[model samples]
Target chain A: MQVHVEVLNFYARQMRLLDALDVEGYAGTFTEDGVTDHAHRGERVEGRAALIAGAKLALPRYAGAAVRHWNDHYLIEEVDENTLAVSYCSLVTRTDADGNVTFEPTFAIEDVLVRLDGELYTRSRTIHRDRPAAAA
Target chain B: MQVHVEVLNFYARQMRLLDALDVEGYAGTFTEDGVTDHAHRGERVEGRAALIAGAKLALPRYAGAAVRHWNDHYLIEEVDENTLAVSYCSLVTRTDADGNVTFEPTFAIEDVLVRLDGELYTRSRTIHRDRPAAAA
Candidate 1:
């Protein structure tokens, strides 16, 4: 499979696990010692265990809604034979039981993916929340 | 150059054209005798000319807002050497100048695409508005 398609499919599966609140499954998409840097919040969580812990704590915020991450404008680069640098814009939506939908602020994300036995897994991810331009 | 990746890239470009309200440019993404069937509205437009005309008429509706179609769950099937059947769920949003966003009803769309001169173009599109399940 092509790298672009592989990367996209990886995200499709990873995001579904996340939105479904399958914390362990979501963490499985990353390397054992993967790092996630919340650049906007200046918080970095390292390793799959930490990822699972953080995700568990965040679960309550989505207790009664279906949260989805819609991503676009993917830019992927081959950093080496087995490494990829990827980035995209993400928009999140939460749909309640009544089917009303609400949005979260947009975000930009970058990641480093490495091939493990022909499958891709995230080695690192950095997320930046989108903000309006400051007045000059 | 996998089919799945190609189809996604095609949509990324095509949706941009539609959202940007580049009527002619958008129409150009279809074949000369393409067809658009708005199943929910019972409108079937045939040919590039008709497509362009219908789009132009709808342009006024998007005058002040930037409309975007966020699509998910793309399913692609190769029907022949140069033909593909594709389907996906689409979520539409319109962002106003003030940055507030509103959504249109969700839609499920199926499309037939043909490859001509190494590029893909829509030959037929059928769009169905998603509706709640009818009471039993």
Candidate 2:
């Protein structure tokens, strides 16, 4: 069995937008009142605008770092006909100035996605960090 | 929408077994041939027996730590109606001997689950740690 096409596309777009630092585009992937929980950092931000603001602040930290995100694999469970619970592994890497590559960070993301008006948007995201923010 | 009862039960049993430090029981959650990728630790353990051995080697690290795991939420995706992809968030807390409690770890896990002979077992697990193990 294979993953749903829409699910794969969603992550692909997300990764592209994030790596490109398209903050607005990336934030657009969520609902207007979506929520993101960065549990490892003890951070929670709700509402699309606020999520955008948070990303705006955080994404810059990785600027010029050549960070790339890979939402490598996912498992999906249908919550209902209109909603899906999607979980997957997120692997991140960075290329150094000297062209060396190192593993930056990796974790799992548990997200709730709803199909509204025939389009899918993330309603909530909870990132489980195997590595914690405090430790960093 | 709600998570499937059986899927939820699987996690419940796995969690119960793990917190109890029941290595054999915990390993039983996996199929006879299962894969556990502790990538951050550079550990790739295969087979139920090896998984149990790995648990034996690792569980003692938390012997006196009063550790507990909470799997808060999950997203499920179905593949062929028999195999499923499940992802979830894990929050771990450790209390000291004095009863001081602090949130120590949070992470996400992505797993491949297969239904076999009217039962479900974990086939593969890939954990993404927000924090890297090398630093820990």
Query: How well does each candidate superpose onto the true structure, as a TM-score?
Result: 0.63, 0.56
Per-model RMSD to reference: 5.9, 10.8
Q: Candidate 1 local accuracy as lDDT?
A: 0.87
Question: Looking at model 1, how many pairs of residues clash?
Answer: 0
Top model number, lDDT: 1
Quote the positional error of residue B15 for candidate 2 in Å. Answer: 0.5
Candidate 1: residue pairs that collide:
none
Candidate 2 residue B110 Cα shift, in angstroms, is 1.3
| Candidate 1 lDDT, B1-136, residue by residue in tens | 4887788778877886786688899999999999999999999999999999998888778865667787889989899999999999998877655556677999999999999999999999999999999999
lDDT, candidate 2, B34-109, per-residue tens: 9999754677899998998888888768766677776633567888677999876565667779897654434557
Worst 10 residues of 2 chain B by lDDT: B127-136
